[model samples]
Target chain A: MTQPIIRLEDISKIYGSGNTEVRALLDVNLVVEPGEYCAIMGPSGSGKSTAMNVIGCLDRPTSGRYYLDGVDVAGLSDTELAHVRNRKIGFVFQQFHLLPQLTAMENVMLPMVYAGISYNERRQRAEEALTRVGLANRLSNKPTQLSGGQQQRVAIARAIVNRPVMLLADEPTGALDSQTTQEVMAIFAELNTSGITVVMVTHEPDVARLTRRIVWFRDGQVVHSHLAPSELSQTAVFS
Target chain B: MDMLESVKMAVKTLTANKMRSTLTMLGIIIGNASVITMVGVGQGAQRYASEQFESLGPNVLFIIPGSDDARSNSFDLPRNLTLEDAEAIANQVPSVEAVAAQLQTQQNVTYRNRTANTLVLGTTPEFTTVRSFDVERGRFFTDSDVQRNTRVAALGSELAEKLFGTANPIGEQIRIRNVSFQVIAVMQEKGAFLGNNQDDTVIIPLTTMSNRVTGNTSPYGTEVTVISATARDEASVNAAQFQISNLLRLRHKVTTQDDFVVRTQKDALTIVGNVTGALTLMLAAIAGISLFVGGIGIMNIMLVSVRERTQEIGLRKAIGASRQDILVQFIIEATILAAIGGVVGTAIGIGGVTLIGATTPLKAGVSTTAVILAVGVSGTIGLFFGVFPARQAAKLDPIVALRSA
Candidate 1:
C-alpha cells in the first residue's frame, strides 16, 4: 500500500492541568491513506471535532506524533503551522463562513490572495474553481444573495481553489435542508473521486453513508469503524 | 495584504457606513477650520495695522515737550519748545527736511449766530509741507502772515463747511476767543490721523497765537504742545530722529533727563506689531485644543470600528493575514478619514476667511503654513488615535476568532 497521507500516533489533548484537566482527545491512533474519503461521527463533546481540529492543524495535540505526508507537525511553530494549513489543507465549515462583504468569486480567491498570486492569475484560478462547483454564473453574487445550498457550494469552491492536499470539512451540511444536503454531498463525492482526500465530521448517518468509511467516536476515543457499500443510495436518509 | 488592497478595503468599509464616517470626520473638519480661520484673522489684523501705519509716512517724527519729564517728575518740568527751536533744528540737522512748531488750544468759534468747539493751531508757513496737509479750497498761511502776526486764519475743510455753509469764507471775519480774525484761506480736509481729527482744527500764524491769543503764559519761551519734523526720505528717518533729539537736548540745557520725547513712525509700527503677534499666538493656542478634541473623536470611532469588525479580523488572520496587515488596515481607515476631513476643512477655512474679509474691515489673510500645518496635524491625529485600536485588532488570536464566528 502507498504510505498514509496523514498519520497520527498516540495523539492526546488535555484541556487544563491537575484536577481541572479535561482530556479532549485520548491516545487517538489513526492513519488516512491518500485519496481516501472518510467520515468521523460522535455525539456532542465526544472529541470528533477535536480530532478534526488536530488533523487540520487548527489546534495542537498535547502529546502526539502527527505526520502530514511525512513531516511531524509537533515541531512546527505557529507561523509554520499556518503556512502548512494555507498550502496543504482546505477547510469547509458548517455555517458556510463566506465573508459577507466579498462576492462569491472574491471569497473563493481569498487563499490565492494570501499566496501572493498576481491579480489576473488569481481571478482566473478562482473562476475555474467556481466553475468546478457549478457556480460560474453566480460569481458576482454575495453570500446573502445566494441560497443555503448555493452558499455551501461557494464554500466548497473556496476549499478546492488552491488544490490542497486534504479537504477537512466539519459538518459541511449540518445547516442545509435534505435536498440541499444531498447536493452538497454529491459535490464532496465528486471532489473525492477526483483524487482529493476528504475528512469530514458529522453526526448524521445519511451524510456519513456517502463516504467510503465511517469512524465513530465516544468519550474522546474512536469506538467503531465500518465501510459503506461502493454504490449507495442518493435519496435522503434521516437516521 | 498589499497596501493597495488594504486601502481599497478601508475606503469600501468607510463608505459602507456613510453617516458614521461623516459624523466622525466632522470633528476633525471643524477643528482644522477653526484653527485656520482664527490664525488667518490674527494675521490679517497685523497686516491691517501695519498698512495703516505705512500710509502715515515713515519719515515723520513728533517732538512733544514735557512728555518724558511729565511721566517721572512733575514739579521741575519745563515746556521748552519754541518757533526758534524748530528753525534751529531745520538749519542744524542735515537729515531734517523741515521743522514746524504748533501751539494747540481748545476754543469756541462763532460764525454768524452758530458756534462750535474747535482746536486752534498756531503754526508757521512750513506746517502744510511738514504735516502732509493738502489745500482743498484756498492756500495756506504765507511768510507775510507769520512775519506780520496778521489777524487771519485758515479754516480746515470740514470746519469750513460747518461754519460757513454754502458761503465763501475767504475775506470773511470769524470770532475766535471774542477776537475777530479774517479768514484768508479755507484749508483742505485732512482725515483722522492717529485717532485725532485733523479736519476739526483752524491754523493761524504762531506769533499771533502766542502774543494775541493767551498772552504767552508759558514760561519756556513760547511754549509749544508738539513739534512736527519730517525727514528727507524714508532711509534718513532714524538719523533725523537722533539729530533732532540731540538738538533739543542742547537747546533745553538738560544735564540729567531730557524734557521731550521723539516718537518715530517706525516706533509706532513696532508697538502694533508686538500686540498683533501676541494676539495671533493666543488665538492659535486656543484653536489647538479643538484639534486635540478631534483626535479623541477619531480614537473613539476607531475603537468602535474594531469592535464591530472583530469577526472580520479573525477571518482575515485565518486566511494568512499577519499582525502587521491587520494593524495597517485599521490605520489606513483612520488615515483616510482624517485626510479627507483635513482637505474639506481647509476649503471651509478658506471660505470662512474670505467671508470675513468681504463683510468687515478686518482682513483675513490665508497663510500656506497654516494650511500645511492643519492638514499635517490632522493626519498625525489619525496615526495617534489609530494605534490603540489597530494594536488590539492585530493581537487577536485567529483560532479564537474563528471559533467566535
Candidate 2:
C-alpha cells in the first residue's frame, strides 16, 4: 500500500471556551496522496489559514489524528514536531521568508543545516535547487538584490533543497505581480510534476484553478472538496 | 541547530548591524578596561611604597633607647643609654656586622656672618656604613679622630651650599656656638625620609659633639640617642637583634621590663605593603562594579535583540530551527560581543599601564591574573546575561511571531 503523504482525521481546533469559543476547524478529514498538487481555497473567516497552519505542523489541532508520511504526528512534542517539520515538510510563505542576512545559497542551505547534513553536500544541493529554479548565477545574491519573482524562486529552492516529502505554501505568490505569480506557479507545478507533493493555501480563484484539486472551506468545515473553478460561481462559496 | 552553524549565524547577524553590536559591547569594554588599569595602578602604588621602605637600608636595625610604651607614656625618657651600650653590642653580638650611635642636637653655626641654626648629628665613623650615607667631598673622621676629639665636622650638601656658596667648603673654619670647627667633608645628598630632611644637617665626631658642642648632660659615660646596627646579611638580622637585646638587658641590669626596642625595615615595609594592598583591592573592587553594570547592559541589549529579531526568529522556526537552536544562536551572539569587548579592553588597559609607567614614578606591570580574570569574568557575564533573552526568543510561538512580524 502506498501511504498518503498527509492524512488528517476528524481534526478540530477550537479557541477559547464558553461565549468566547471560536471553532476554527470541526471534524475535518483530509488526505493528500503522494505527487498530488492541491489548493485550499476559502473566503475570509473560513478557517482555511488555520487549516493550513495545522497541516504545516505550525499549530496542533484540538482533536485529530494527523499522519505525515504515514507516521502519527498529532501527539508529538514541540521538539519532535520541529524534527518532523525539518525532515518532512518544506514551507514557502507569502512574503518569501528568506533570512535577510543570508544569501540565496545560505538561505537554501538552512533547512539542511537543521537536518545535520554535511556542509559541502548542503552547498551542492542548494546550488542544484537554485539552478533548477533558473537562479544559477544569483547564488550569492541577497534577498534585496532579487526581484519579487526571483525571491519567491529562491524561497522555493530553499523549501525543496532538503528534499522534503511535502512542499507546503501559504499564499506563495500573494506578494508578486500577475506575471511573477504565474512564474512562481509554474515552478510549483514543475516541482509537483517531479513527484514532490504540493499543498497551497490561497483565496484567488485563478490561483486555485491551476491545482488539480480545490478544497473549499466554509466557516470551519470543508464544504466543497472537489470544486472546479468554472463551477465555483455557481455555488455560494461565501455563504 | 549545531554549534558551528549557530556561531556562524550569530556572526553574520552581528556583522549586519555593526552599530548596535558595538554599542551593546561598550559596557563590557569600559568595565574590563577600567578593571585592568586600576589593578595595574594599585600594583604600581604597592611597588612604589615598597621601594620607599627598602631605601631605609637592608639588614639594618635601630635600637631605640626606650621601649615603645615607655616612650609613649613619658615625654622625657630616662637618659640611661650610653656609648658603652653600643660598644658592648658591637663586641658581644656575633651577628652584628657594624654598629653606629647617634646623638642629635640643634646648634647655630657662623661662617663669616652667614650664621644659621642647623641640626647637628654626632655619630661614629661606622655611621656612614650602617646608615648607608656617603661622603662626597673630603674624608670622614676615623677612629683615631674620635679618640683625639678632633674639632672637625662634615657639612650636609644643603648646609654646605648655604654656608659656603661658590667657595669650596673644605678646610673652611665654621664656628659653632663660638667654638671653631673646621669643615672636613661635604656629605652627598640624601633625600627626605618620613618628612625629615636628611640633607639639612651637619655631622661631627661623637667625642667632639659630647665634650665641646653639647655638654655632658648624663651621669652615664658619653650619652647617646639611638644605636643603629647592620647585620652580616639579610638572614642574620633576627640573630643580631636577639643577641643585642640580651646584651642590653644584661648590661642595663634590667630585672623587670626591657630598657630598649629593636626595629627592622621589614616591619615598616610590611605595614606599607598592607596599606597599599588594601588600597589596590578597594580600587579593583570599584572597577568590578563597572563589570557588573556591563553585564546588565549585555542583558538589556540581548533582550532588545530578541524583540527586534522576532520575525527572523519566527521564520527560522517555521523553516525547522528548534528552540534549542535559536537559543544557542542568540546566546552565542551575546557571548561573542562580550568576549570581543574583553579582549579589546585588555589591549587598551595594557596601553594605559604603559602610559602610566612612562609618565609616572610607578613601574606599573600588567598583572596576568587580572587579565585572565577580567576576560574570564566578562565572558561569564556574557553567558550569564544571555540566558534570559535567549529563553524568551526560544519560547516565542512561531505562528504568533510570524503574524506579529
Candidate 3:
C-alpha cells in the first residue's frame, strides 16, 4: 500500500517558558494520504496556522516524528527542510505573497529557479502553468495589475507549477469577494480532481465544507476529524 | 540561484530606484575623478621639472660654492669660483666634456629708448655648447673677445624681440648699464624652465661683464658666479661629480665641511621625483576618503533597501533563495554602482587633464595604470562596504520578515 503523504505522530510545539509559556500544538497526531483534499478549520488562536506551518516544512516540531513522503523531516536542517519545501510541498498564503516586481510568468517560474531548472525550460513551464490558470494573455502583468481573484489564481498556479506532492494554502480565499471565492474554490477543486493532494486552513465553514475531509483544532490539540458524507460513518474524535 | 540571475535582479531593483542609485553614486564619481586628475597633475609636475633639468644640459653637474643648508638659510655664498678654475677643469679633468663659468647681474638694457631691466649673463664662447644654446643669427663671440674685453652681446630670443621688435637684432647696438654694446647674435628660443625664462636674459663675454658691467667687485682673480660642466656620457655623471668635488675641495683648501657642493642631474631628478610622488600619494589619499564615504553611502542605502524590501526577501526565501543568494545580489548591485561611477569619473578626469594640457605649459597626461587602479579600487570598496548590509539582509529570518511585512 502507498504510504500517507504526511504523517505526524505525537507532535508538540511550545513557545516561551514558565509563566510566559504557551503551547501551540500538543501531542497532535495527523495523517494525510495521497490525493486527499482536506481543510483545517478553527477559530482565531486555535493553532490551525501552527499546524499548517508544521505540515508545510516551514517550522520544526518541539517533539515528534513527522514523516513526509515516507521520510522523517522533523529533525532535518533548515536548508534540508527548505529543499523539501521547494520540491515536495508548495505553499499559498492568504496575502497571495506574489513578488510585486515580477510578472505573472516570472512569479510562477520562481520555484523552478531553486530547482535548478534551465531558463528555457522554466519559461516553457511557466507559460504552460499560466495558461493552465487561464492567465496566458496576462503573462507579463504584475501582481498589482491583476484582480483579487486573478492574483489568487496566479498564486495557485505558482504553487502547483513545481508539481509538488501537495499544495498547502492558508486562507486562500479569505481576501476575495464571494463570487471570486467561488471561482478560486472551483480552481482548487479542479486541481484536486487532477489527483493533486491539497490541504487548506480556513475559518469559513462554507469553505471547509467544500473539501473531502475537515480536521478541527481547539486551544492546541486536535478535537475532531470529519469525513465526507461517503465516509461520514468512520468519523474520528480526540479529547 | 545562478550569478546571472542575481545580477539581473540587482539591476532590476537598482533601476526601480534610479534617482537614489544615482545619488548614491555621486560620491564615488567625484572621488574617482579627483584621484585620477590629481595623479595626472602630479605626474605632469614631475615631467615638467625633469624637462627643466634636461634643458640645463644632458649629463650635467653643478658645482655651487655653498652647501644647501647655507643656501636655505639665506646666507651669502663666498665669491670663490674663478674662470681659471673652469679652464683648469676643462683642461685637466678626463671625464669633463665642456665647462662654462658664468656671472649674472640685473642691469638696465635700452634700445632706442626702450629700457628694460634685463638679466645680464657673462660667460665664455663655450657657454653656448655647454648650455646647449644655439645661436640662431650671426655668431657667438670668440676667446679673443673675452681677452680684449669686447662689449659684444648675444640677445636671448625674447630679449631680442623686446629690443628690436620686427627688426633683425643681430647687428644692432643696445646700451647696458650706460655702455653701448653691439648685439653679435640672437639665440634661438629655449622656452621657460622653473619660472625663470631662459629666453629672457642677455649674454655677454665674461671679461667684459666683470670689467665693464659689474666693475670687478670680486677681489679674487675674476671670480665668477656658478660653474656648469657636462660629462662626456651618461655613465660618467657620477665620476664627473666625484672628480669635480675633489678638485674643488683641494683647490679651495678646505679642511671641514668643504666650501662647495657638487650635484648631478640625477640628484635633482630624484629630489623632484620624491616630492611629486609624495604629493601624488597625498592627493590620492585625500580623494580615497570620498570613495570611503561613497561606500558608506552605498551601505546606508542598501541597509535601507533591505529594510524596505523585507517582504520581497521573505518571498524569495520562501521560494528557496539561500542566504548566499541574497548576499550576492546586494553585493553585485553595489559593485555595479561603483563600477559605473568609476567609468564616468575616469572620463571626467581625462577631460580635466586635457583641459589642463591645453591651458597650461605642463604636459598633463592620463596614465593608464591610474585609470585601471582607480576603477579596481572603487569596485573593491563597493564589495567591502556592501558586506555589512548584505549580511544583515542574508541573516534575516524569513518568518519575521514576512510577519513584519
lDDT score at residue A89, model 2, on the 0-100 scale? 92
| lDDT against true structure, model 2 | 0.89
Please tell me which predicted candidate would have the highest lDDT against the true structure: 2
For model 2 the local lDDT of residue B56 reads 65
Residue-pair clashes per prediction, in order, are: 1, 0, 0
**Ranking by TM-score, best first?**
3, 2, 1
TM-score of chain B of each: 0.73, 0.72, 0.86
Report the poorest 10 consecutive residues by lDDT, candidate 3 chain A.
Answer: A230-239
Clash pairs for candidate 2: none
lDDT of 2 at B277: 94
Q: Give the Cα error of residue B91 in candidate 3, in Å.
A: 6.1
Tens digits of per-residue lDDT, candidate 1, B151-259, equal 8988988888899888998989898888888998877766765556789888888888888886674765776777888999989999998888898888888798777
**What's the lDDT for residue A96 in model 2?**
86
Model 3 vs. true fold: TM:
0.86
Ranking by lDDT: 2, 3, 1
Candidate 2 residues lying further than 4 Å off, grouped into runs, are: A230-239, B55-58, B62-127, B139-185, B189-236, B239-262
- Residue A157 lDDT in candidate 1: 90
lDDT of each: 0.85, 0.89, 0.86
> lDDT at B304 for candidate 3?
91
> Which 10 successive residues of model 3 chain B have the least lDDT summed?
B65-74
